[model samples]
Target chain A: MIRTENLCKRYSRVEAVSDLNLDVRAGTVFGFVGENGAGKTTTMSILATLTQPTSGRAYVGGAEVTADAAAVRRQIGYMPDVFGVYDDLTVAEYLEFYGTAYGVTTPVIEARRAELLDMVRLTDKADAYVNTLSRGMQQRLGVARCLMHDPQVLILDEPASGLDPRSRIDMREIVKGLRERGKTVLISSHILPELADMCDEIGIIAHGKLVACAAVEVVAARANGQRQLAFDLLSGGQALAHAFRHERGVTDVLTCNETSVEILYSGSEEDQVALVRGVTLAGYPLKAVREVGASLEDLFLRLTEEPVLPSGA
Target chain B: MHNVLRGWVLHNPLLHKELRQRMRSGRTVLGLSMYLLIIGAVAFVFMYLNVQGQTLLLQPARTAELFTFLSYLQLALISFVTPGVAAGVISGERERQTLSVLLTTPLLPASVIFTKWVTSISFLSLLMIMTLPLYSIVFLFGGVAPSQVLAVFILQLITLGAIAGASIFWSTFIQRTGWSTVLSYATVGGIFLGAGVAGYLFDSLSTHMPDQGLWSMLSGICYTINPIYMQAALESSRGFFTPTFHNSLVESVFQTVKTHNLTSSGSWMFFMSVYVGGCLVLLGLCSWHLRPGTFAAAVRRFGRWLVR
Candidate 1:
């Protein structure tokens, strides 16, 4: 539902978004992972029709953002980072105002306002002033405001940036619900694990370029194939290392001490279990065994550490 | 056509939302009350001071003078307050980080600018309309005609459009509300005071020589550009109000024009077109500023045309 082709945005001398290409399919959650000034917000803004690219094109719902901006606007709901609410308005009134601004009818807005407030879990606080809500509640209200027009594509930039852990979880669930409702959501965040949990596809953007883009499971599977297995032995650590050094699935075993060894095992969990059973049956001292999972951070570092190609390339 | 008109009248969402928010605001309520109170107090106090140590009677001249005072007072207050009302329209949205979200809706820049203009002018209209009970003082005394009151209001409306256009232009051009407000006031003030001084110099230079056609016409143009001079003429014409005008450059030049066989309404028409045309130009500038890509695209097309 959202696509960018060689989109470049320059502000005076600084290139905020440089030759970026992206494709987000309909009805799937695409997480944009990047650090500050990685051009994530700029890319999202261009897709939302808020910023014009210096060159190339962007489209939402098959309409070019710059040429058919009004149509694209009708098809996408954009939530900006560091947004604010009208302090004088109540939560319901805020949603009602945005609904009206989006050209939603009174009757339609009245119905959607209730539904959206309920969806964001602000139904009970509907009559309360927006300024009275907490930060987390306000962020949720921002999401509700975006969904007020029922746009098919949602452009959310840093939706859970400043929230506490529980609030972040709440926001993650809200996004998960959006996916279930079949809305294409393009969300950018620094929270990789949360994105990993919620996104079907993840794109890592660095230095104003997309370095890696793929499904979460595919990336995780590639990273998970190499396991860091550690074992502490009461004795015979040399025997354990020698026994596992020649094993088919064991790549390398580093003997830490006379009583401990760590193995880099490229094997399935079942194979590792069988190998451990064989070691125990062979009567080598095996006090403990633990497999450490590869974190999203490790993947992010491995991806970003790769050499970036030239812009046109 | 009917649907378009109906949509503009009843279904303009930005206009509706702005009106709702403004009407419910305590600041708006306080502003209305304070505006009415100031006008009432000024009228009563002027009456008391004029009748001090004299027997109070229904004097036509006193009432007429009071009418002029009230009109000038209204003009001054509207001029000063309008920039505050409009200069923050766009920039405040930016400050709140709501501008991007607002733009990502189906609203074009023209629609948003139209809504801002309508909402600000509507608030000013409400303030003007609420002063009618006070204007009834002049009506009860039988000095001012209903048409004169209507004329004064129409002149005020034109002035409102002019100043509101400047405010909107500054609001679009500047990113900071503070700077926009300051520049808005400066624009209005520069037109009133700057044109007043320049018009005076031109009038003095051309008063004795009516045959100096170009100088006299230039002087007339300068006088017409000042909102204060225009309001003074509208208020003082045909005994609508008979107070001594502080700035006589426009009125004096207008009399010279009448001597040269030009109708008084000609002056009104000339300046009406000028103010309204200038307002449209400023609004166009505002729309251009709000949509940056429009400017860039124009530049690109111009470049390609130049090369061709």
Candidate 2:
């Protein structure tokens, strides 16, 4: 539903977004992860047609963003990280105004307004002035405003940035609902775990570059054998460590306590099993053995870390 | 086109909403009261002077001249006041942070500009209408014809619309509401003052020679190009039926005041056409400047250079 080719946005001497390529499929929730100043907002703004890219091209729903911007706008709904609400307008009035702006007919706008307000769970606040609502409620209203025209693509920039824990959960559920309704969504957020739970595909960007992009499961699987394994031994701590020191699959082992040891290993599942058996036969009573799966948080940190440059001769 | 119009009308709820809010606003009420007080005081002083000197009241044409004179005074007041009403139209939206939402809609930037221009003029129109009773009072004393009054009002509306349009355009170009408002006033004031000075200089330079000099030709061109000059000429011709009062301060100040004759002049029509056309072109330029791609490109380039 969205694609960019060597997209580069330069402001004088700073490259906010550089040579980045992305393809987000229709009906999939794509989470864009990045730290502050990581080009997430800049990328989203370019896609929203709120900013022009310095070079390259982007297409939304088959319409070239630069060449066919009006048509692209018709198909995409943009919700900025911070949007202003009319202080005097009721929630329903605000939605209706945007509906009209988006060229929705009166009757259709009314029907859609009702549906969207309900979808965001703000039906009860329809008559309430937007400014009178709490921050979370206002954010929900922003979501409803985006959905007013029934857009095919949705770009949400940090929709949960300042929300409380409960509000964040509610936002996640709303995003999940959008995915279920077959809308292509691109969400940017700093919370990696929440993204892991909600996104069908994830991309990690750092220093204006997209370092990693793939399905969550695929990224996890690629890091499988490279994972660190932790073992809890009940007794024979010194002997078990000595025995595993020369094992083929185990690269490095660190004893955290008298009963627990962590090991970095490069091995298949069978090799892991054999290593566990070898440890048990060496006289240490094994209480528990488990392969620690790399969390999205870990993956994000590792990918964002700057590569070390070789020293000059 | 139908959709565009409908979307434009509905998209800017702020237009009507703002008009209604201003009408009920305390500031507006105070302004209206102040205007009425000023007009009333001026009329009262003129009437008292005429009543005290019975010789001045004998000629019925003098009464008609008084009404025409007062109408011109009102027009002058509107010219000065309309800018204050419109200077904040677009800049205020940006100040309130509502501009982003308004800009993001499917409505074209031109539509937004047009709506803002209309809203500003409409507010001024309402104030003018509210002062209709004052004009009506002029009729009671005799001498003012309804058609002459109507012509003056219409010309005032058009001239004010042009000024307001220019102000709105400037507001969109500048960043701060305060600066835009000040700049708008300065620009309008500058144009009026500059044109008058240039015209006078040309007139003086031409008189010094037996032949019409370059300065005279330039003066004629400037007057023909200026919208205010066109409006004044139109009003003078349409209001030719009224007689002049030589004793009034207005008459002494405007010694060349022409009596009413409604026949439109070719030069007047040319100037009016230019004024209307220039307003449309400015509105278009404002819209183009506010479009997303233009703003984005400027911002992106500036952002890059700033980082370096």
Candidate 3:
């Protein structure tokens, strides 16, 4: 439901976001992963219609952001990275204020207020002053505020940034619930594992470019060419290494101890099976043999490696 | 139009919420109370002084004149107080990061601006209204006309509206609420002080009968263009105490013949119109400033010009 075509934003002499292209389909959670200064916030701000792009174009819900900003705003909800809470207001009052801003009828807002607060698990804190709540509670309140209008799209920047483990888990569940409800969410976060768990598709940005964008599994597979295999042999370490050394797909096999070995091999499932058979036939007792897939953390680091353009060409 | 009205109606919750928050805020309450105390002390001193004179007390017309004079003085005080009340309206929202939430809503920028202005000036107007009892006490002595009092209060509200509009306009340009507050005060104070000084010097030179140098040119401009001059002229003719400008070549030259014959209320109405018009212009400027692309580009252009 959101797209940007080579969108660029320049602040005086500095280019904050350049040649950035993004497409987020409806009913999917798109994770925007980036380090600091990756222009994630700038891109989100442009999408939110809070700031105008210097060049290029962006659209939300099929309406051009620059041309039909108010319409786009009506269709999307934006929660900033550093969302500030009005301390004096109660949680209910805070929601009510935004409800009015979204042009929801008072009765509808009131009816939905209880449901939203319950969804965020802030029902007890409805009458509590917002500032008195913990940071995680405040962040949940911000999420609830964005949901006040039942917006079709949610652009949340770093919604899980500062939350504790339990709060982060809660946030992930809330996001998953949004996805299930068919709301498109574009979330940016530093925590790749959490994003991997929640996002249907991922975009890794670095130095103002979307360096990698794909499904989590696809990205992990591309980044990891070789599968890692570890075994705790009942007897044979030396013989297993000797046998693995001669194998075509197995490249590096290191003996961990008297009974354990680790191997790195670029091979299909059949090749892995054949290696297992060879180990068995070699008369060494095999206790375990399994392929290890790459983690999101590993893929993230690999894709975000510094770009090295060749020297002086 | 229906959407606009709906937006305006929707803004009331925000308005009510803001007003309640301001009332509860210690700084706002403290500032307002201090202002009221100062006004009370000033009124007490003025009443005591008049009681000591006994001369003003004896003449009913003079007493009415004196009350009108005090009312005008209160209007001048409101002119100063308004910017302080309104300088942070928009900037404060930005500082709190609530502005983005407001902007993303369906509410138009003008409605936002209008609602903020009304909320701020309503606070100032409440303070002004509190002094009504003091005015009524003066009226009990049978000197000031109710029409005169009503006219002055209306003028004060209009002037307050203008100041509030100007402050909000400036608030949109600056980042920090504190800086906006300071800059608003400086701007409003500078205008009144500058105009008063220029008007005084020109009046002095034109009446001194010496070579009317630059002062002669400015005197014509001041008489025709300055709202303060219009106010002073209207007040002076109504027997309120104000400096008398001598009938001079410049005054005759610049003064519209038809305007010169207008009654005091008519002149007051004219000045009020100017004040309201000035307020609308300021509101328009504020709305322009709040538009997405204008503010940042303007700042960049200004920075470039400064560098050059």
Candidate 4:
């Protein structure tokens, strides 16, 4: 749905985005993660055709952004991080303005305006001035504005930034719904866990280069080499610990206390479950058992901590 | 033809948005009312002083004087109000962070500027139209013909376009609205007041010089370029319109055009063309500035294509 070919954008001495390539498949949400000034916005801006890349090229739905910018613009909806509203316009008028800008006819705008307002939950505030709405409502309106043309690709730069917890959740749910409708979204944010949960693929960019890109499960598996399993034993901890050490997938075992045992088990999930049944049938009383894998937060920190390579290196 | 016209009218979304916002805001009403009050008061004062103790009546000569006075006053007001209306067109969008969003759409840079130009002209046109009753009063007295009044409006339209173009150009170049507005006023002042002063000084100096001297030539050039002086000379040449007002320098340009045997209307058209041409040039520059980095990018791309 969106692709960049070694895209590089330089502003004088500063390289805002350099040697960056991205591929977002159709019908999937791609979450872009980066710290402040990490070139996330710059990359998205290039794709949106708001700024020309100093070199290299980008395309949306196979149309070169620079060569066929009008076509690219028609296919994509861009929501900048700090968007401004026409303060004097009511919510409906604001949407109508954008709808007309995209050359949508009046009848279509009228019909779509109602559905958009309902989707953004701004139906009751249709007649109210946009400036009077809360920040969360305005952000939702921004989302609706992007969706007004029923675009094929959505490039949202930090859509959830600066929102309260409830608003953030609301935004998350809205993005999830977009995916359900089979819309391709490329979202950037500082929140790692939210991206991990919502995104089919996550790409981490730093210092103007994409350092890591993979599916959510692949990243988690890379972060956790071995799953840690804990078992609360009714008795015979020493016997169970010995038995666990002798098991095929048990790489190491530890006695947490008289009633518990911990094992670093390298095995598939089904193998782990079967081992639990084996332990129970082997006359070891089992109270409870749990398996722990690396969380997205741990994976994010681990990846970001790696040394960043300069562009083209 | 109908479809094309409808598409042209309906496709310009920015103009619709601008008009809606302008009408809803109290600024439009306040500006129009203030405009009427100021122009109306000036007309009333002219009438009051003309009447003294006698019963108020329209005099043909007084009507000519009123036309001249109101014409100059209208030009001055148009010049003063245009920069305020246009200087914030682009800079205000940037300040509000809406320019990027607008640009990201399929909206062309030309459309953005064209809509702003139309909206500003529409506003100043309202002010120009509201003072028609004042013009009608002058028409009733029968010293100024309908054709002359129409010519003066054509001149006003040219002036409005020129000032609005310069202001929008500055707005595109400058990042801040305040600076753009200030620069627009300064540019307009240089064109009108600054040129007038220079023309006056050179005219005074040429009076003491020989007829074929360099000072006389320089004075003639200044008067030809100075719109205020040109307009004053054109109005003075016609009988009963500002009889006491005389500009020898501008009259020389008029005489030169007449020596070629161009009629008075033709001479005025030749003079007004400079203002109209200048407005087009300024608007062109404004559209260029609105798309920053595009020219260089295109140049680079062309260079690469040629190399290939």
Categorize the docking of model 1. medium
Q: Clashes in candidate 3: how many? A: 2
Off by over 4 Å in 1: A220-293, A302-313, B53-56, B205-212, B239-263, B293-308
Error of 2 at B217 (Å): 2.8
Q: Tens digits of per-residue lDDT for model 4 on A47-93?
A: 98888889998999999888777789999989999988886899999
List each model's interface RMSD.
Answer: 1.9, 3.3, 2.9, 1.7
Tens digits of per-residue lDDT for model 2, A227-258: 57888877666666666688888787855556
Q: Tens digits of per-residue lDDT for model 3 on A1-313?
A: 9998888899998888777788889999999988898889999989988889999899999988777787898998889888677757889998998887777988999999999999999999999988899989988888899999999999999998888999999999999999998999999999999999999988888777777777877666655667778877888687777777878998688446658888888899788888788788877888888655557887777767858212111
Q: Is the docking of candidate 4 incorrect, acceptable, medium or high quality?
A: medium
Rank ordering of all candidates by TM-score, starting from the highest:
1, 4, 3, 2
Residues A1-313 of candidate 1 have per-residue lDDT tens digits of: 8888999999898888888888889999999988788899999988887788899899888999787676888888889888877767899888887888787888999999988888889999999999899999999999999899899999999999999999999999999999999999999999998999999988888788887677875655464457778887888887778878789998888546678888888888789889889878998778888765456777777666766645322
Lowest lDDT block of 10, candidate 4 chain B: B254-263
Q: Candidate 3 residues B97-129, lDDT tens each?
A: 778867777666776788888889888988888
Error of 4 at A139 (Å): 0.7
The alpha-carbon lDDT assigned to residue B120 of candidate 3 equals 90
TM for chain B in all models?
0.86, 0.80, 0.74, 0.82
Q: Sort by lDDT, best first: what order?
A: 1, 4, 3, 2
Runs off by more than 4 Å, candidate 4: A223-293, A309-313, B1-10, B56-58, B201-221, B237-240, B244-273, B292-308
Model 1 chain A: ten consecutive residues of lowest lDDT = A304-313
Cα-based lDDT for every prediction: 0.82, 0.76, 0.76, 0.81
- Scored against the true structure, residue B298 in model 4 reaches a CA lDDT of 61
Q: After superposition, how far is residue B79 of candidate 4 from its true place, in Å?
A: 1.4
